[model samples]
Target: MAVAATPSAPIFVVADDHPMVRDALALSLGAAFPGAQVEFAGSLGETLMAVERRPDADLVILDLDMPGMNGMAGLAQLRSSHASVPVAIVSAARSPALMRQAVEMGAAGFIPKFTPSQEITDAIRDILAGAVWLPEVARDHQLAPVEADLALRAAQLTPQQHRVLALMAQGKPNKVIAFEMQITEPTVKSHVTEILRRLGVQSRTQAVIVAQKLGMEPPAAKGS
Candidate 1:
């Protein structure tokens, strides 16, 4: 099903690595909206693919701990790539703090894994209606300045820059990063330069430091 262009039917991409969790979310979306179409992806990679297939996706329910997505990077990636879609995080470890950060990074909502099916539906509906749906408690906790800055910086890195930064964090040189990323050395150098510039760092070490501190690993950043 395509992401909705009209309210008559909406499409939701529910991303989680766990099969059971995916099934549960699909069921919840199905039950909540009789005509809604829900698709499932086991990880952030799959989620991105699904979004590519349906760039007009109405909403996305993402797993916070899905493989390849750490901290706020996955949320950032999705928000940046699919700016029109309203995305939300669904996690077993939901918290007021994380929710605030997700919202600050551009999430449309935050749905706790423990949220009842009814509330989940309500939250999704609210977001689709152009409202920011978040837990009441999350409104009280704002990210510290450093964390906010980190989240913003991570969000700024493109997928290739993220990959280069990740390898650099492990102390890999340009040659190794190019090999691992299956790109040319010059491309790797370009990525490194962009990474440093985006992270506001003067050098590789500083870029890695900033990336790791900001949790900049996206699923595709594992190299080409």
Candidate 2:
């Protein structure tokens, strides 16, 4: 009998409101796998749009306290819309019950917000390898569960901005991205400026944090 083929390189989408966080994550993922493809979404609406556009994405890195759509609700929405896509929650809210709930709601794993960059990548790699990404805290807290319903709010984004954000998350320079995407460098810079404003960050490094909190890769050294 023939053996099944190994899974392809995983594609990731990060949903967070921090520019430095997103930038950091994009950098980290790029460094980790060299050619791995990664994308970013600053809000719930953008997150949904990304999934719709790239339904075959291997995984999603989600955050808990986004501006409009809370992390839990977004997770549920994603579960409902794309039941097949795997999800991993990366958040600073260290609630055991919530982590368990996320898993029950179809999340493949949970990465604590302060986890090292390498750990984050390791979790993604584990999930991609068909292993669970839950921390020990989650397993222990599963016994005593608290009941809470996190609500999600509505948000919107322009299609053009969404595409620009996706390319930016791939670690492309403005000029190169503009050329490849058929837009002017000035336009690309404007989109990036708008991204920082909407995400409420001053620098790209800060955006990376937000991205990592959302489960996206960070720009720092793998273990640093």
RMSD of each: 5.2, 13.1
Overall lDDT per candidate, in order of appearance = 0.72, 0.64
Which pairs of residues clash in candidate 1, taking residues 3 or more apart in a chain or in different chains?
none
Q: Estimate each model's TM-score.
A: 0.69, 0.60
Q: State the lDDT at 205 in candidate 2.
A: 63
Candidate 2 per-residue C-alpha lDDT over 121-214 given as tens digits, one digit per residue, 9 for 90 to 100: 8887898888877887667444342222210001122334434544455466789868976989999888777766655668766544433343
Per-residue alpha-carbon lDDT of model 1 for 1-224, expressed as tens digits?
A: 33333468788888888888888777777777777877778888898999888776788888867676654656667777788877888876544555655776688888787888888888888888999987765654555666556556665666566556666766788898788768999999887777777667798777766755544333333224
Task: Count the clashes in each prediction.
Answer: 0, 22
User: In model 1, which regions exceed 4 Å deviation?
Assistant: 1-7, 52-56, 64-82, 91-106, 110-119, 134-141, 169-173, 216-224
The prediction achieving the highest TM-score against the true structure is 1
Off by over 4 Å in 2: 1-8, 141-224
Clashes of 1: 0
Q: How far is 18's C-alpha from truth in model 2 (Å)?
A: 0.4
- lDDT of model number 1: 0.72
Candidate 1 structure, TM-score to reference:
0.69
lDDT (C-alpha) at residue 76 in model 1: 66
Error of 1 at 139 (Å): 4.9
